[model samples]
Target: MLLLFLLVLFTQNYFSHGDLIADTCKKTEYPRICVSTLRSNPDSKTADVKGLVRIILKAALGKANTILNQANDLLKKTKDRLVRQSLNVCVSVYEEALDEIPEASVNVGTNNFEANIEASATIDIADDCEESFSNSPFTADNNAVKQLAVVAVDIIASLG
Candidate 1:
């Protein structure tokens, strides 16, 4: 069963009827301003496809780090143990999300699927973080969790 699911996912990602990879590459241009500032100069290290993927990875990582830092900072400011615990989970999720990229790169290669992989990683990280936050010590504080959720959503949106 697991193998079947894996096969389905791989096929859907790489050989779907639609060219989601190309579409995602096109969307990467939307964050050119953010990418330029966050990554190295826009010099032609490679073709636009690879260059754009690099930019997307850089920008997504930057956004993820920023969100994680904000959560940590907020936790530090608050003495509430629940908030601190939730923030710790958020931190862990961000770390795992960041950690997955290198492996994903190896799996998908740098030339293609980079943007798609980054987006998928961001979504996974956000979902995991949100789930962890909601069920932990901070279950009562929906408002703060909502704010963190907004940050995750913004990070995903910014990537596009």
Candidate 2:
């Protein structure tokens, strides 16, 4: 009986994340990233679609802040005025993204279309930042936030 109970518990734990995160993430462009990230968060073990949006948006916000800091740090180190200018552009968009993410978080399930618009902006922010670098941008960081934001937007659309 104990072994059967354990097996049931294990299966419940496994399939909880499996079905919820899987169904949602399959709708995203980057399914692996979405599943891995959502599964990494303890809260996601039981999260509904709205809860998942909160988690992804939070991750996007953190990554945006990290990339903003990287751009600022590079800005200070560079001697070339052109590189500094590009860094400035990155810095600006990241700041704009920072503002949008919080708003997105607030609107998550209430009016998901609003959340979708805000989440959509993060993808553009990453693009603009990368374009400004013209060479080396926060490739990984930007990709992380962009993919997370895209996932959030797609999920938000699903809610509405």
Q: Which numbered prediction scores highest in lDDT against the true structure?
A: 2
- TM-score of every model? 0.48, 0.90
* Model 1 ranges off by over 4 Å: 1-46, 105-119, 131-160
Off by over 4 Å in 2: 1-14
What's model 1's TM-score? Answer: 0.48
lDDT digits (tens) for residues 98-131 of candidate 1: 6654444433333234435544665567655667
| Clash totals in order | 0, 0
